[model samples]
Target: MKKLLILILLLPLLFVGRQVYSDDCDTSSVSNLNESQVKEMIGKCQKNWEMIVNAKKPHEESLRQMEKQLAAFQARLNTIASDLKQKEIKINEGDALLGKQEEILAHRVRQFYIKSFYNTPLLLIFSENKSNVEDVVRVLAYQQATTNDDKKTIIKIALYIKNLEDKKKQLETEKNQLSSLQTNVSEQAGKVKKLLTEANAYQVKLEGQISQLSARQEQLLAEKYAGSNYPMSVGETEPSRPVDDRTIDPGFRPAFDFFTFGYPHRVGMSQFGAFGRAKAGQNAETILKAYYNNVRIEKRDNLMGNINVNGYGSKSFEDEYLKGIGEVPSIWAEKGGYEALKVQAIAARSYAVSYTNNGQGSICTTQECQVYIGHNKGGDWERAVNDTRGVVIVSNDTNEVIKAWYASTAGGYTRTSADVWGRSTPFTKRLADLDGAGKAYEGPSYGDSPWFYVAWGSRSEYGNSAWLKSEEVADITNALMLYKADGGTLIHLSQPDKSNGDTWSSDRVKEELRNRGKNPYNSVSDVDTSSWRNGNGITSTVIIHGDAGDNTFDGGDYKYVFNIRAPANVHLKTALYNVEKK
Candidate 1:
């Protein structure tokens, strides 16, 4: 019997040993992960860092070139302006010279006309006739000859004057053309100078950003050592926002609160669960590649809400929508209608909330909160987030989500502002040699110093909430007003409900809703709404310890207790159980 006892004791010790050994990690899968993996990962991260820093390299060089070109262009412009001024003066002098030439031409033409009219006529009259004729006939012939000679001289002089005027007009046209060319060149030079000035300013801004990134990278590296090992878990609780059984009128559609429970952005599939656990220094790209050929573009609809919608006439719930029921009219409970929000509340209570603190935080616009400013690819995610401007309703009975009333974060209204950090301490991203603890002093490997430290900076691992835009408040308030317009109970999850940490509840939440203009309401019991109790007050849900079934109460372990299987992509860390056994 003593030997039997020793064996029994040894069995427990063996089990414990196995558990401890499991903690050492499974290195067999990564046989080649000596120091090589670490170097490769760090190298990739460093490269990405460099790309961001060097985004301005070309611009900086362009700015320098611009400065050089600008100065040269300016000098050329100045010289052109001076030469243009001198040319303009010379043009004026040429005009004066041309005017003098025109005057001389006019005087010569006048003299020729005058000489032709007087001397030529007289010469012709005298030479021609007195000897040639009968008195009347001879006189007439001489007169005609004289007249012809005079007309010929006048015609010649007029032609000469016309040629001189044509020459003068051509000279004026050439001068105007030269002035226009000078003006165009001057305009182009001015444009280049303006562009150069803007480019220099842009380069300076980019340099500042590079400095900030360098400092921030160092801070990130420092936080690597302080990382947490455990994943976050959700606690058990009765649904705070319970569905009403009597409240099930026809044509009810339970509006699922989207912002809080909508599927979270997926992290890349991990060969190891978390990024830190993967090969150190390896970036997400390399690690992801090594595990799978490449990151597959998985359809997001593959991960739908985790709930059994049998009342809606479907055996299983698919992606956030109801099939077959769409054909049914609003009057039918089986089709276009939902079980009063109360009946649906029970199934949801069995469902778990997300691992993060569901949208409760100090929302802000500063880099502290990493507000999604509608500019990048990630901007699309902003549409679905609640920016802390509205209210959310939960069932008092089970604490499952009932509704999330969101405000528009469109305008300039703000609810709050704060930063989320990766570490408690601040550091720079220096490329220096790291100590045993990976602490940095300084070097090429080291980046510039950071401005601030955020405790929960990485949403990839730690998870994140949204920043409420000031503009969203009225829309959020109006939506909440609609829920309050009818009758709805508001349950707050952040406030502690019971003495133990097992649950969280708040009367203040209901009051807040009422203040927001919701109708007056009363609290109901979870036992009446949930499968918490049978006829004898003997519980059917989980019981962990001794008699009254109160030790650690959880729902049953029956896989399909609610006549449903767990949904795909559902994350259940804490097991639920039935309290049937002692």
Candidate 2:
């Protein structure tokens, strides 16, 4: 029993000692793993988790059984103890009765001895009468019979006391055995509990490893399908065009349509909106003033003669640099987009002057700065540049050149600098980009940009359809629920990679939702925008109806979680986007 107790006390220590020497699940190396390595590691981690769970089950059952056995042993030991106590009380009573009976028998034997030694010998010695002698013999016989009966009664009482003592001793022996058995069972239970604890800790460790592997996988996939992969610049010289989702047929019914209001950053001028305005007989100055609030078109002569251009050394700011900027299509000039070209020219020139701080800094030659091709883009583009010679957009409040940030499209509304970058600028304003009567000109007669409103995805890669399936949409909703619950650890909840065997199954996501105390949906039945940013055209609140129920979420959060958890090629281009269920 002592040895068993000592072993129980040492069980946890032994387990700990073994764990200290054993190989642990080291997730620190996850960052160094490539996609293939990460997938392999995830598989191994999952297998390890299964092994730990399997190992823990038997120990848990054994612990339960041991607990029940210990309870039974305790009850039996109590019963034995009670029996022994009652037998002891009876044995004590029997001992007192036997003592009294023995004393009484001794006194009676002494009185009979005195009477027989005196009276009976005198009757025999006198010999006067036979009857007298006969009477003395009868009295002696009766006394002997009475003494025998007393002696027999005392013997029976003593025998009964002995039987009670014997029974009490047997019960005590049984109680000792049960107590030892109970201690053994308790010790076994302790050992099993320790084993179970160790198993649980190992399971947690494996789970952590799996999470790290998944996060690394997600990072790799995100890098593969970065937003930079999309074309942010627009011009005839730009190589790629945005994929129009309308041209493709979504093979599945009840599609979840992700309608984006704009293509890129909606911070400044909308290039297509300018085209539409120019088509509607608006001049370059009018279009620029409409987008840039409180800004004037002014020709500045104090500008530097030469500005440093990245990868091409210094160049003339007006004569050489302005001619090569290819922001809008030259073909638009033939199609009544001349005023828009002039607007682009002036905006590009003003942006360069402010960006360089009057030639103090160098600028890159990408859309990140401005798309600049080396030679003069002789054509309508050159004509527009020359027509707006030395002209720059200057802020009225600051009396300085404005940055004049612009993008390809703005859906229907433009965002302010404060809305986009969290820093307010005097020149930038959130405008509806509509006509005088609150009518937009972006559909057929004007800008006609393909990206005005469309679903986003890699159509060439994923079945020529930019629309999402019902289950896929539900998965995105689940991702949002998890993000709302615990956004920190759910970084890897991206769409599963089937090729690499690192898929986060739909059932798995549902299980996680249940574990986090959030409802999971099987399919998204409908989705609609609940609120919009007043005058900004950005969706604010969205309500998603699923099989589980309807849930409301912040628009920005929905966009963020959707981008991260959606398929690699599919993503919302901006936060100011909407979702439609078809």
Candidate 3:
């Protein structure tokens, strides 16, 4: 019985030990693992990552509460300090008054003694003047009465001084105790913050491990299924055409088309929007000012120095580094987009200077930073670079060079750094890329970006079909329902066609949906989309009418499920999207 009790007590500890061991994702052995083993590892890592993420919130809240408490304690300590200073002043004033009173009492005593020595009662009685004797007696009685009052005043003042000293001592003791408490609370807050930071670092480590494992899994799958057409994920600048519903025969009378607003992260200056604005007769300054709010174009001639470019070491900042930038098409400069090219040059220059911290650091030659193609791009690009000489975008508030983040397209709206990356910057603003009439100029007549309002899919893998069938659409809704009902492995909800392994079959998904008290649909009859603009624009709500019933989903949730469950060939690239029913 004792053994049984001991085992019961140890059960929780054993379980915790196993959990900790599982959470330690050692990717060093991933290379030797099979496809199934890698996928299983990914699942475990993802689960652990979620657990860490959820656990971070409480610690963060506790830290915030402790900080508030610390502030309150500081304010209270200040008040007590101020009170002590005032009490000390009063005590000094009382001491000075008591000294003055003591001097007056001593002088009065000397006067009384002198009068008694000179006008003795024996001489008054021997003299023949009775009135003189009575006057002397009255004067002596008055002097004695005044002396008694002075003694009472001295005693009262002494008692008051003693009380003040006692109160001051009490305040000092209280102050010391409070200071100690504040220190302990501050230490606790520091500990909480450290734990939160460690958790964040652990989360990053887990994510890295998962990324490595996923890469291995992808490699293993690619090796296993050689010669099979596996669709590639969409790139930022992949040339794509808009889905024309009139041409696509989806093998059904009624079909739906999903149109995405933007291609990539919709933050900072829109390159295509800049081109469009420049074409609209706006100068380079105006184009830049429109994208980045409250900024000034400043010329910093002193920034002329050498910048270390990876692979191509130590290039001239003004001439060599700026010329090698191949961000925009050089041909655009010749075709009435010279202002846009100049904007790109200035933006690129500013980004380089800020990123390198005035030539103290090194920048890479990839889109991860700014694309730096070695050697001068020459032609109009060279002219654009020279035109913007030493000009860079500076934040008016900070008076420092802005990062000048620019993307290929922002669809129509741009988001702040805080909205996208959880870090706020002073210069970036969320603004609509609209014209005088408050309409986006990134459509057919303006920016003319192919990624604008296009269905996402790699054409090579889908047999040139980017459109979804009715049943496939229904499967997406089913996946979303199951996800909302029971939070499980996200990849399990992925479409069977694109899933490498460990995905729920269509039948199993529908069964799970039904088990969770959700109505699973066979085919989507009709779909409706609603959108409202915010930091992350459009596609706010979606309502789907299926054979089983109608279901409504939040747009962001729908986008998440769509990206996960949709085929690799076709996925929603951004959250801002619309659905059309025909």
lDDT of 3 at 454: 64
Report the number of the highest-lDDT candidate.
2
Worst-scoring 10-residue span by lDDT in model 3? 12-21
Worst 10 residues of 2 by lDDT: 13-22
lDDT value, candidate 2, whole model = 0.77
The local distance difference test score of each candidate is: 0.27, 0.77, 0.75
TM-score of each: 0.21, 0.60, 0.66
* Candidate 2 collision pairs: none
Superior candidate under TM-score, 1 versus 3: 3
Question: Which number leads on TM-score?
Answer: 3
Give the poorly placed runs of model 3, Cα more than 4 Å off: 1-119, 128-259, 292-308, 314-319, 349-361, 378-404, 413-432, 436-439, 456-536, 540-568, 577-582
Sequence-dependent TM-score of model 2 = 0.60
Expressed as tens digits, the lDDT of each residue in 1-582 for candidate 1 is 234224223421101111111212222323233222322333343343334334434444444544554454455556556655655665566556656655655665565566556555456566657553345345455555655655555555455545545544554454454344445434544554454444445434434433444344334323331332111110011111212212322221221110111001111111111112121343322322322221221112222233223222222222222121111112212221122111111112111121113322122222222111222211111111111111122333334342211111101111111111111111111111222454221111221111001111112211221111111211222222333343232121111311223211234434555577543223211111123223211123432221112222223222111111111111111111111100
lDDT of 2 by residue, 1-582 (tens): 355345344443222234332354567888887654575567567666766665666667667766776777777777887888888889888888988998989998998999888776766878888887888888888989999999999989988988888888878877786687677667767777877777778777777777788779768766756552445657655335456665656666787768777768887888888889999999999999999989889888898888899999999988888888878888888888899999999999999999999899998888879988887888999899899988999999999999999988887888887676444799998888777776665544577876677667664454555678888889888877875787553534656643234445667878888999888999988888846546557888888887899888888878866766676567777766766655
State residue 321's C-alpha deviation in candidate 3, in Å.
2.9
- Tens digits of lDDT, candidate 3, 312-407: 999998789899887888777656778988999999999998898989999998876888878887888899989999999999989999998888
* CA deviation > 4 Å runs, candidate 2: 1-230, 237-244, 459-462, 498-504, 530-535
Cα deviation of 35, candidate 3, in Å? 12
